[model samples]
Target: MHILHLPPEVISITCQGLEYRDLVRLRATCRALTGPATDAIRVKAWTVPMYSDCVMYKVRAIGEEEPIFQGYSFKKHFQHHFPQWLEGNLVEVQLLMSLAQEDKEDGLLALKQLTSKLENTHVHVKVVGDYSVDKNEFKQLVEIVATSPPNMTFGIKIYMNGAIGDFFIPDKVTRLCICYCRSIGDFPQFSPTSRCQVHLEIRGGDTDQVLDLFHNACQNSRNLSLAKVTVTVIPLTDPLMSRLETLEFDSVMLVGCLRSTPIPPTKGITCKSMKKLVASNFEEFSYFTSPSLRRVSFVFTDRWSREGNFIGLQRLKKALERCPSLTKVKIQAREHHLGSAETGDYWSDFFNCFEHLEDLEVVIIYSESPITGDCLDTDIIFLGKALPRLHTFCAIDDFGNSYVL
Candidate 1:
């Protein structure tokens, strides 16, 4: 049978099975079938690049006025499949755009249209633009997105040089990430019902007030991360800490109150429901005790005093004593610290604490001092015996080779 004799629907299905390059060849074969063949190729090309409902907008390295994806015929196909995809999948759509040199209006317009079509779809807008943008112009864009749909679920993330003002986030937004945004005095407030998973890398802000805001608006949040913030004092009874299931802190300071006016510790902050925690400092883990914790990770650094006061993983040793349900543990320690003779005692103590750990991973970053073969073998054997439920043990050698034992 001649290919041209096939019905349009049959042709469409057949073309869908062809590779992108093959479809390109099919387009040139016959002028009569070019349109249908090209449409099928467009659908696959567009959907292939959408990673988890994300539309990555790319621009030329040199002089280019428009995004590479602009004026493409894939929008129609995207809208057709979006509803079906969202039926079972989470309604989280991300629009990542390059705003480094061009106007941000186009990206915002695309975000608005996408949210408009998928009612109540949670949108996460990420823009790579000039951090030093005009405040007034940026504010206008912010208002448009914030007020687009009265009941829309949306989140706006931008790297701005200046401090953020009182901008509204749609109550239904589930995640918000803002890096290098300075909010010195006043930070944006969320709705009472907002439970957004916040990841803020703030530069200049009264972090104590920021923590205070979390208690007020983000009471329902389960996952929270704060990076590069000067945390003055973290009370054991903060409402936000009580409900968290996953918490992460990187380069966060904990300046305990002065000796005269110290807040009475309420037997350390207890999160009976927490399952995972990743932190750079080990001392912070002491305050959090999760009976249901399954996974925990820590980044060990040289500046123990600057990060936290824990001598040779003592706090981590104590912290693990509480997480009886832990199943996985990851420790990334500086090479010098782990290779020293004194750490041998600590490792023995640390390994003795795990009982239900199934997956264990360790990365000892090598510098002037590297871990020896004997050290690695001993640790692996110790781990295998200590963890009866252990099934996988992984470690990275000095040559960056990952070995599974």
Candidate 2:
């Protein structure tokens, strides 16, 4: 009888199907349903599910039960030199991920049947980003490859832990594609191949002679993401860009494009102290020019991947007209479905390229997922009325909830 005598559109369509610790215990038993249950929990509904300490690179797959991908890796080469590069009586594993251009050749034929018959295991394969690693040293090299023996192939070691936070990242980073590999760890020490490679003992130290005695990657990096690697002397070429003359990055997150090695591109670079830039390929928005950039994050991948957000939006509106100090923005996607109508003019030129960011206040979005689907409330209320120093806008994810666009 008295559901506040109903109608605030039936209490936001019955508290929009409750769940956020039961709508905060029904807005603590009504104080006028706590402003419609905090606007129905910012219109996101609910789903936190774990993982988000502002996420500083993460990944998983060891007795997988769910959680598997948020991206950002190496917590000190997997908590300290990845257990000293896979210790003894050996069988090691390292297989990192980011391969979803239709699971690139069936994930390298399921990792060459998990490394074509192991015989005294020692695996090393790094196809940068997504699902590839092993350690106990990585969970005891996947429990000695489930009790080894059979055509032989068990030991997949890959650790992209290029010291960050004490800074020592000179990981010569070799972008690999494991075509039934042998040796490939993109130097620091580990290169041997007449046919198939395996060797690791960066242990007497020589990762660029300890990153050349810490120049702190060009004096205490504020933020930097340099990909476009190379350093092959024994089979492996093209991928070298250590262009550091000046960089005082504040934030730069370009993540996406790797359905099996496909990122090589560079011939543009300029930064007078980047504030924030997260671009997922548009050929790196003409490769970056931050006029003291403020904040930007656009990463969309899934719907089976086509190299994240390949819609360019007129090359991100000429790279947001060369950052007029972007106020703040973040967009994350996981199931990436631009809600029908053949992507609706790429979200109508992605909301008319932020109406000239004017001095944009804030706008954070994470569609397709935060942990799985649907969060595009009419293109976020049509990008909060097509920006103009947007006061604030929201819609977080990982399914805890977020709304207010």
Candidate 3:
């Protein structure tokens, strides 16, 4: 039967089952499928990377809906000066470093234009860049954004290796994610207590630097409840600990050996409130010891050992032992390894580690080889033996097609 003839509710359900490309095609079939299909598209769009870019180019190109202007991207060919387009109409702007170096005049003009259009809008500005911006330019950009909206929230991510001077920001910002940036020089400089929530992600830095930044954030955010603090740090330490609701660590970098000792607790810090953790790495496997963590995601990279094989799995097993409350676990690993004999054993062992996991997603890079009998049988066996609590088992192969349960 044709999809258009189905009841709206049924069509919605069916649309949700289809791949994103298929849904887009269905939306073009006729008006009967348009409404439900569009809703599905929007929901799916948000989950997809660069959703704003897609909406801006596709939906806007056809004069459907004006896409939300969440941030700006400068056209590279145009002297790298100003943004070629503004994305997402949301009051918040997240400007990545890759798109920040357009000509200063063009960027400033575009910012002015954007502010004019979004004035009186309670906006949040997140500038992600290395500290390559000139002092006056950076100050000017901050001042302009702050002046535009009193209720605005602003944040800056300076690369960990770069130097930055003290700057004032509006008190509207309650959430922040700082990647690879260290040195919180003064603890009281930034008052985070007035805000409702705060998040910090530290990457690619020394353990001392990471601890200093975390401690500074905690000390300044006193008025905020401990539950509002969330931190992600590599080489986890006790001094950097806080009574956070969400605590994450890059395990591959932190856990050097399976026998590595856990960081001891600090005198005033408590991590009992943590609810989520992420362990990612390219080398050795990592683990977490959060008793209250509800979700854990592992991101594996293409790294080879002296024997030309992937890193340790026992470390990962050890990590899983610490997260008893884990309901969801996602493993993003290389596809070739997943289909290999070694990988089959690793997958089996990994599954055995999760006793309470309800949602399991395994994303493997694509490969051209057909699913051999050995690989297929191994996967079937693993799936069959998975935890009884497992409700959603999804495997996305290299080609992006999903095997869902």
Candidate 4:
């Protein structure tokens, strides 16, 4: 009789002898065989047996849809970044090989020692790499992470060239960053089971691809960061944006702006729960209003406009007007020279909007003809009265001159 004709239990036991790749091939042969092959692969699977750019393995029992975490190399060089971790033999050989491929012995010894250390200590772990691991070592490392004690944090960053298959995303890992990897195939999405904070970063996918993974984070994620990702549009009203305490956008272009203009707390989907927001540049600001927002920062480049004639500044001002709960705000404007017309009580009025403001910092690239100190001094007087709750306020120009009130 063929394998498919065997009893399910017998088929599962037989398939268990096959390696992960072979089982995947076997599972593809027939629809009926997928059940047994999947069980065999799940119950006893391991990472690829060779050292490669990326590795994949299963993290849960057979038949259950557990996430596959794909470990890859990060493009950036971070060899000397973790001197302390390096000194203690906490670095894996595969990760080190990612940095220095010539040192094969060092990589092997490092992997062995790092796996030993993690298995014994179960401490907070961070794995950074550009290299791949052989099957045995990868299996041991996964085991350490799987059995890690509660309260331990785990972070892994993988940078690789092409698509990663069967990526194994472990549960409860605090931070999982995949940089420059191609695609995340079907697996348990990066949704952690516990209340543990999860941070995910995906890079180099189709610009128009909607990140359905974020939807899984609606109720659990504490923060979300997007960099250089081109998505058609992620609605501000998305549940993923609703529950987040902090949202950061870096080099991300949204097809639609969040709440084109501020909407009343009643008519719109207010991110009233978000506490902090950050934008890499003016364009990244989605203008999502949160009645409970306490902190915001925007770094404006010279592209916005020249010197004192800044439309970005005006837009930022308007955005700030809507956040009544803002307590701390920081704005960095490059190549910004405040013309006489842009000066005066205008700033005082701008500062007046944040009634609960506590800390304000403004850094501008002053032009040769910068605003006069006298004018800034006068604005300070008005600001002091309008913002009674202000404690620390400082404005620094590109020339290193500062006025603090």
lDDT of 1: 0.47
Encode model 3's per-residue lDDT on 50-133: one tens digit a residue: 322211112221222223222334443211221222222222333321234544444344444445655544434444454323
Candidate 3: 10-residue stretch with minimal lDDT: 43-52
For model 4, what is the error of residue 294's alpha carbon versus the real structure, in angstroms, after optimal superposition?
Answer: 2.8
lDDT of 3: 0.42
- Candidate with the greatest TM-score versus the true structure: 3
Best candidate per lDDT, number?
A: 1
lDDT scores of the candidates, listed in order: 0.47, 0.42, 0.42, 0.45
How many angstroms is residue 24 displaced in model 4 relative to the true structure, after the best TM-score fit?
57
Q: What lDDT tens digits, residue by residue, belong to model 4 across residues 79-131?
A: 21222222232212123222234544443444444445345333334454532
Count clashing residue pairs per candidate.
Answer: 0, 35, 14, 13
* Candidate 4 structure lDDT: 0.45
Alpha-carbon shift of residue 128 in model 3 (angstroms): 2.3
Give residue 303's error in model 1 in angstroms: 10
- TM accuracy, model 3: 0.53
* Between candidates 2 and 3, the TM-score winner: 3
How far is each candidate from the true structure, as Cα RMSD in Å?
Answer: 11.6, 20.6, 9.2, 20.9
Ranked candidates, highest TM-score first? 3, 1, 4, 2
